[model samples]
Target chain A: MRGPDAHGRFGPFGGRYVPETLMNALIDLEQAFRQCIDDQSFQEDLHTLLEEYAGRPTSLHEASRLSDALGGARIWLKREDLLHTGAHKINNALGQGLLARRMGKRAIIAETGAGQHGVASATVAALLGLTCHVYMGEEDMRRQQLNVFRMQLLGAHVVPVTSGTRTLKDAGNEALRQWVAQVEHTAYMLGSAVGPHPYPMIVRAFQRIIGKETRQQFLARCNTLPDVLVACVGGGSNAIGFFDAFVDDASVQLIGVEAAGSGLDTDAHAATVSKGTPGVFQGSLSLVLQDRHGQVLPAHSISAGLDYPGIGPEHAYLHHINRAQYVAVTDDEAMHAVEVLARHEGIIAALETAHAVAYVLKCAPRMPRDAHIVLCVSGRGDKDVSTMMAYKEAHA
Target chain B: MNALHTTFAALRKQGTVACIPFVTVGDPDLEVTRALLPALAAAGAHVIELGVPYSDPLADGPVIQRATARALAHGTTIGDVLQLAQDTRIDGLDVPLVLFSYINPIMQYGINALIADAARSGISGLIVPDLPYEEAQDVRATARDHGIALIPLVAPTSHARIASIVAHADGFVYCVSSLGVTGERASFASEGFALIETVASLTDVPVCVGFGISAPEHVAQFSRCCDGIIVGSALVRTIEQHSEALLDRSRRVQATRDVAHFLRTLFSQSSGGAQ
Candidate 1:
C-alpha cells in the first residue's frame, strides 16, 4: 500500500533491526536489489522462471453453484491453490531465490509454520540448485510431518527448532539467528510480508504479482473490479498479495479475515489486528498479543497456519492507514465453510483459506443480492484434510 | 563529551594509535571479568569492547563463540555486564567501554532501556556488529542523547557503501581484516592492508582493524596502516586455552596486563619508537 523511502520506515513500522555485522551486507543487498529489480533483463528472467517453472497467471474461476447455495451474493475464487506447490507462496520464494542468486549468495534459509512456505522454498531451491535450509518449530514439524517429508524429499534440510514455544514464532526466531550468523553468503527468504524493512517490502513485491493478475482477470470477467475482495491472514501474505493492487482504489473494499479459533473473546485465537496493541516483534512494529510488560503471549487456532500471535507489519500499516478492514472468523464457522466449498464446488480448501470463505458466507447475507465478491482460495485442503477430519469428528 | 572522545584525543596527543581489546564479559566467570577491566585499562588499553553474551553469534569464530557460550552459561547478560561496569567503577577508568553484541539480545533487553542503563553505567560507546549503519538511526539517536558514541563497522567489501557508513559511524571505524568471521589465521593478507587504506581514505575517523588479527605481526602490520589494532579471537583463544592461568586471582590481573602490554609493544616497535 505504501513504499518505504530512503529510510526503511513504513509509518514507523518497518525499520531494520538487524545486527551491525551484517550492515555492509544489507547495504550491498539494497544496492543490488535496487539495480537488479529495475533491469529489464532481471524482469525477463523472473517472468521466464515464473512462467516456465512455477506456472504463472493462475486462473480466476466463478463459483456459480457455491454462489447459488449461498443465495445472497455472487462469488468468484482466484485459484492460487491451483498454482504449483498448491499455494501462492511459490511466487515470493522464486523471486527471493532469484534475488539471492543475483547477489552471489550460495545458500538460502527460510522459516515455516504450517510448512507451505517451506515446501515452496524447497521446490525453488531444488530447481535453482542452491542449498536450502528450512527452520520449523518442533510442534509444527510434528503437526505438518507430511510437508516436512516433502521438503526433505526436495533435498532441503529441515531443522526443527525447539526453543521458545516451539511454534511459528520460535521457528522465525531461530531462522533470524541463523541468518545473522551467516549474512555474508546466505539469504533469508522470509515466508510472508512480515519482518523488518526490506523483507515486508520485498515479500510484498513478490506477492503483488497475485494482485496484479487478479485485477486484470477480474476486470476482464466482470468489466470492473469486484465489489469486495477477501483473503485469509496468517502472516497476511495472501491477503496482502491480493489487496496491494487495490489499496489505492478506494471503491474496491478489501477485507482481511484472521483466524478467531474458538472465539476472539477466548485466548484460543490469532486475531492480532482485531484485538491486539502495537508493539515490535521479529524486527517489525505490528499489532501483537503481548502482556502489559510486553512479553509475547501464546497464540492458538484450529489451523496451524493461522496460529501466529502477530500479523505482518505491512498489515499493521494498512490497518493504521484505514486502507483495509480486518475481521475475525471463528473455528466453527471456518469448518462449516470448508464443508460448503467441498460439497458445492468439489474443491476442499485449506483451513486457512476457509477463514476467508467463512467470513464471506457470514457477510454475504447482509450485502446486496447481486453484489459481486472475490475470495482468494489461497491453498489446497489436501495438506489440511487430516486436521479438518479430526475437527469434524470431534464436533460430531 | 563521552569518554570515547576523550580517549581518542588522549591517544592523538600521545601520537599513538589506540589499542582496543575485545573480550566477552564473564567468559570464565563474572567475578574474574569484574576484576579484569580496570587492569586492562591500567595496562595500556585505550578502549575496551566488552561483549555481551548471545545464544547464537553467527559472525563469531570458534574462539569467540566458545567464549560467548561460556559467558552465557555463566548467566552473562546486558544488565549483568552493565552492572559489572557500574559495580567496579571501571566505566570511569578513562578508557572507553563499548558494548559489543548482536542485536537480538539488545532488542530483548529493550533498546531504550539498554541505552539508559549503559549511560548510567558510564558506557562510552556501543559496537553492535549485527546492526547495519543505515538501520542504526534509532540506536544512534538514543546513544547520542545519552552522550555515548554508536560506533559502526565497515567490512572489506564496503567500497561503494563507504560514504553512508562514514556518515553514521562515531568514535571510530572498525575495519574487519577479512570477509569471514572472527578467528585466528596463520598470516594477514595484503588485502587487509588495502582495506585499511581504503577505509582510511573514506573517513577521517580512526580505522581500527580486527577479525583474524591474532599474532604480533598482524598487529604490527595494522599499526603501520591504521589508527588502531583490535585483537579478538587471539585474546579469546588465550583465555579459553589458558583459563586457569588467566583466571587465577593473583594472575588474572597480570594476564590482561601482559596482553595489553604485548599489543602496545608490538605497535610501538612497528612504529620505530617507544611509547
Candidate 2:
C-alpha cells in the first residue's frame, strides 16, 4: 500500500475533515498518540490489560476438515471471535478508552450499526468509570435490539438517531456532531479504520497488534508468510489489521471480501468497493455508491455490519496502489459457507466473516496444493443465528 | 481599499448604522445563494458574512444547524464558498465578502491554501468563531500578507482580553452581543450595551455587535452604542422558513425586496434615534 503520512493522508484519501471546534482535541490526541506508541510504560500497561482484562493471545486453530473440503489450500482461523465481547472491536476500544481516561475525559461517545462497537465501547466506559453515549441508527436499534440492551445494561446511554438514511451513516453523522459540540470534555472512540485524519491512523495503529501477533504465530508454525490473507470488509477494521503487516510483501496476496447480497448486478447489495466510484464522504475520499447526481445511495446486505455505502479510506488507497484486491460474495454463498464451516469444524461464524470464508472456498480450490491461507474469524455467530435461521427457513 | 476596512469606513461615514446580513452557502441551493447575496448588497448590507457549512457547527443554534445540514447534504465545501465569491465578482458585485466559518475547514484546506484562494476569489476578510487571538496570529499574518483582514471577536466575558484582541484586529471588532450561541432573544441584555461600550472605548476600529441582535429595536439600541449591527440567525431563520416560497420567481424577488425594505426601515429608524 502507499505510505500514509503522519496526518493520515493515504494518496489523497484520509485527512481531517471535521469542524474547528475539535481542532484542540485532535491536536491533543495527535501528541498523545505519538508519545504513547513508543513509551515503554504505555506498552507494559496495554500488555497487562490485554492479558488480564481482555483475554489476549486467542488461538490460531487449523480447520482440517474445511481444508480437506476446500481441496487445495490449508486454512487456519485466527479466532478473534472468542474475545470478551465476541469480536476484535474490543481491542482498540479498550486501548483508546484507557487513553481517554488518562486525558481526563469525563465522557465517551461512540457510533455503531450492528452494535459490536457500541458494546465494546460500553464495556470500556464501564471499566474506566466514564459516562458513555452510543449513537445507533433507529433502524439498527430495532434490528439489533439485543446488543442495544446489552449496552444499556452496561450503563451507556443508547441514543437512536432518526436522521439521514437511519442506519450506520446517520449514527456516524450524529456522533460527529456530538463530538464537535463537546470536544473539550469528551472523547469520540471511533469503531473502525474510517473517519477523518488522526482517527483512521490512530485506530489502525491500535489494531495493528492483531496482525503483529498473527504474523509471529504463522512464522513460528510455517516458517514464512502465507500465500494469501483473507478478511471481510465492513469499514474494514479486521481486514486492515490482517493486511497491514504484509502490505510490502509482494509475494503475499491480500484479498478483502465485501458483502454482495443477491448480486452486484442487482440493486440489493453493499459491494461498495467492488462496485463504487471515488468520492468524499464521512471526512475522507473513498469508494462510495452514489447516483448520477452524486447523491449517496443506501447500501443493502443480509449482514447489518457490512451494509454501508463506503469502505474505509485506507482500503481505497490500498486498492489504488494495487496492494490489495477486493471481491464481493453473495448472501447465498456466505450463508452456505457459514453452514459448511459449522458442520465441518463445529464453529458458527459471524456473517461478516463468512464472506471471507466464502471467498476462500471459491479461490482455494483453484490454487496449487500446499498454498497456505489465513482467514480472520472476526466475530461469533450468536448474534446472527436468528437472521441465518430466517434465511434458511425462506430458502428451505 | 481592503474590503473589511472599506466596510467599516462606510459604516462610520453612514452614521454608525451599518446593516450586516449572514447566509449559509448552498442552503436551499447554490442558485439561491447566488441571487440572495447581490440582493442583500443592493438592499443596504454594508458587510455580508458568508457561512461555510461544517458537519458540526457547535456555536450555531437549531436554525443554522439545519441550514448547515442542508448545505452539507448538497456536498458544499470551503471551495464551493470561494467559488461563489468569485462568481459574485464576475456579476460585478463589489461588496465586502467576509467569510464566516469555523477554523477546521480552513485547516483541512490548509491555512496558506485558503488564504491564497481567498485572495484570488476577491474575498476581503475572515471571521473564525473558534480561533481565539492566541491561535490566530499565524492565520492573521497570512491574511495580512495577502492584504485580507482577520476580524477577531471580543466577547463580553473577555474583559481583560479585549486589549490584545483589538490590537490584533484588522477590519473591525466583532463584539458578540451575548454569551450564548447564535439565536434571537426576546430582549437585548443591558450587559450587551455595556460590553459594546467597553470594546468601543478600547478600540479605534469600528465595533459591530452580533449574535442575537435580530429585531429592529435591538438594531436601534446597538446603533446608539456600537458602529454596526450584525443580524445573522434571524435572517437565516427567515430564509430557511421561506426557502420553498423563494422557488417561485416573483415570490423570490418580492421576498428579498420585502426583507430589504424591513432592513431599510430599521437602518433609517436607528439612525433617526427613533426607537
Candidate 3:
C-alpha cells in the first residue's frame, strides 16, 4: 500500500500549506493519528464508537427497482445516508473527536458547508463532553438552516461567518482565523478530504470504512467487485472514503461527479476537477477555480455542500493520474435524479449525492446487463428539503 | 546583505525599532496606494508591506479582509499592484517595499513571473501567509534566483522546528505575536516574548514580531524583543473607515494623514526602544 510519502505528497498534491502558527499543530495531529492507528485500544475505541454511537457498518442497498427502471447495469448504493446524522461526515467526525480527546484538547472547532459536517462534529463533541464551535458561512446558514439549528440543539456554538462569498470557503477562513488564537487547547475538526497534509490524510483514513464496507458487502453478495465505482466530489471526503478501498483494483473504474449548478459550459458550477487549475487555496495545493491573476473564484452550486472552488488534493492527483474520471451533473439533472430515487427506490439523497445518482441514471441505461456499479449515497436529503421545495416552486 | 537584511541591519545599528506598516494596494484606489507608500515611508515606516487582494485570505482578520474586499472590488489585480510599486519607485520612494500576497494569487501570476516582476518593481521581499517551509520550496527557489527575499514566518507553535525554519530560510524571520490572524489585541502572552527572543538568539537574520500589533506599547515591547514590528490591521482599519468619504476626491489625503499620524505616534514611543 503506497501511502502518502513522508513529505505528504500525493502525486504533486497535498502539502503543509498553512500558517506557521498551525504548522506544529498539524505535525502533532499527524503524529497522534499515526500512533493511534496502531494502538489496539485506540482502534477498538474508535470502532466501538463507530458502531455504537454513529451506527456504522452502514448497509449496502441494492436499488433493484431503480436499477430495473434504468434497464442496464445493476445499481447499488453504499448507504452512508443511513449513518447517524444522515451523512458520511459522522465517520470522520467521530474519529477526529477521539483524536482530540487523546491529545487532551477540550475544544473542537470545525467548518461546515451544508451543515451536515457541523451537526456531525457537534454530535461527537456533545457525546464526548468537549466544547464544540462550528463556523458556518452566512449564506450556508440560510441555505441549511435546519442543520444550523441541529448543531445548536446539540450544544455546539454555530458562528455565522460573513466573509467572502459567505459560503464554505469563507467559513473555513474564519475557522482557521479563530484556531490561530486557541491552538493551545483546540482541535480543528476539518470536515473534508481537503485542507493541509495530515487533514486530507486523516479524514480519508476515517472515511475509508465507507468503501471498505461497500467492497466487503458487494463481494459477499455479488461475488466480485463492481465494474464501476461512483461518488460525488466536493472537498470529496465521502468519495475518497469509498474510492480508496477500490483504488488499487484496476478493473474497478472510479468515477467522481462534480456539482454543475447550471452547466459546466457556463460560469455557475462547482466543477473544480473539470474546470480548475492547480493552485493553493484554503490550505492545500490542489485544483482550484482561479482567475487569470490567481484570485480564487467563488464556486456556485445549487447544493451548498458541493459549492466549493477547490477539490481535495488526492482527488486532484487521482484525476491527474487517470485513476478516477470526473464528470459534471447539472442541478436539473441532479434534481431529477432525486425525484427518480424518491419515487422508485424510497431514497431521497442530498443534492450533493444526487449528482452521482444523476450520472448513474444516465450511464446505467447503456451499460451491459450484468455490469455492477456501486454509487455512494453520501447523505440523506432531509437537510435539502428547502432547496428541493424552492426548485419545485420555481419550476411550477 | 539583501535589501531586507540591509534595512534591518541599519535599524539595528540605530538601536531603533523598524516600524513596518501594511496596507492593501488599490483599496479605495491605487492612486491613493501610490501616494500612501512614500507617505508611510516618510512617516517612520522602515519597511512597507503592500497587500495584494485575494478572494480568500485565511491568515487575516476582519479588518484586512474588508480592506482586501474593497481592493478587489476595484478590480485591483497583482499586475496593477506591481505597477503601483513601480510607480512608487519612479516617485523615488526610498523605503524597502514588500509584496504580501496569498499563494493562490502568486501561483496564478506564475511564481517565476511574479518574482521577476517583483524584482523589477524594486520590491524588497515577499510574504506568502500560507507558504511555510514544507510547501514553499518551489517559489522559494525562484525567489532566491531573483534576489528577492522570501521572508520566513515562525509561530509560537512551531517550537522545535524554529531552528530549521530560520536556518535555511532567507530574509528576516517574522515572529507571530500570538496564535491568531492579524488584528489588534489587548495583550500577548509572555511565551510570545520568549519565542521571539529564542528566534533572535538562533541566527544572524533579524526577527520581527507581527500579528495583533495595534498599540504603540506593543511596538515598544516587541522592539525590545526583536528587530522590528509589523502594524497591519490597525493601519488598514484607519484607511478603510476614513477613506470612504474621500474615495473619489483627493481630499482623502485625510486617510493618508491619519495613517501617517497613527504610525508617527506609535513609533515615537518605540524610539526609546522598549523599557
In terms of lDDT, the best-performing candidate is: 3
* Pick by lDDT: 1 or 3, better one: 3
Q: Which model, 1 or 2, shows the larger TM-score?
A: 2
Q: Which is the winner by lDDT between candidate 2 and candidate 3?
A: 3
Q: Order the candidates by TM-score, highest first — what do you get?
A: 3, 2, 1
Docking class of 2: incorrect
Q: Count the backbone clashes (under 3 Å) in each candidate.
A: 8, 0, 1
Candidate 3 Cα RMSD after full superposition onto the native fold (Å): 1.7
List, residue by residue over A290-344, the lDDT tens digit for candidate 1: 6543446678887878888888887888888888899999989999999998899
lDDT of 2 by residue, A60-137 (tens): 888889999879899989899988888889888988887887788989999998889999999999998999999999
Question: Per-residue alpha-carbon lDDT of model 3 for A1-396, expressed as tens digits?
Answer: 445778777888888778888988888999999999889999999999999887889999999999999899999999999999999999999999999999999999999999999999999999999999999999999999999999999999999998889999899888988998899899999999999889999999999999999999999998999999999999999999999989999999999999988998999999998999999888888999888888888899999999999999999999888999999999999999999999999999999999999999999999998999899999999999999999999999
Task: Give candidate 3 misplaced runs (Cα > 4 Å).
Answer: B272-275
DockQ of 3: 0.85
What does candidate 3's lDDT look like per residue over B137-240, in tens digits?
Answer: 87888989888889989988888999989986677888888888888888888978999888988998888888888887878787777888899998888787
Residue B167 CA displacement from its true place in model 1, Å: 4.5
Chain B TM-scores of the candidates: 0.91, 0.94, 0.96
Q: Candidate 1: lDDT over CA atoms?
A: 0.80
Worst 10-residue lDDT window for candidate 2 chain B reads B266-275
Q: What overall lDDT goes with each candidate model?
A: 0.80, 0.82, 0.89
> Tens digit of lDDT per residue, candidate 2, span B35-84?
88887778778778899986545466667878887898878888999999
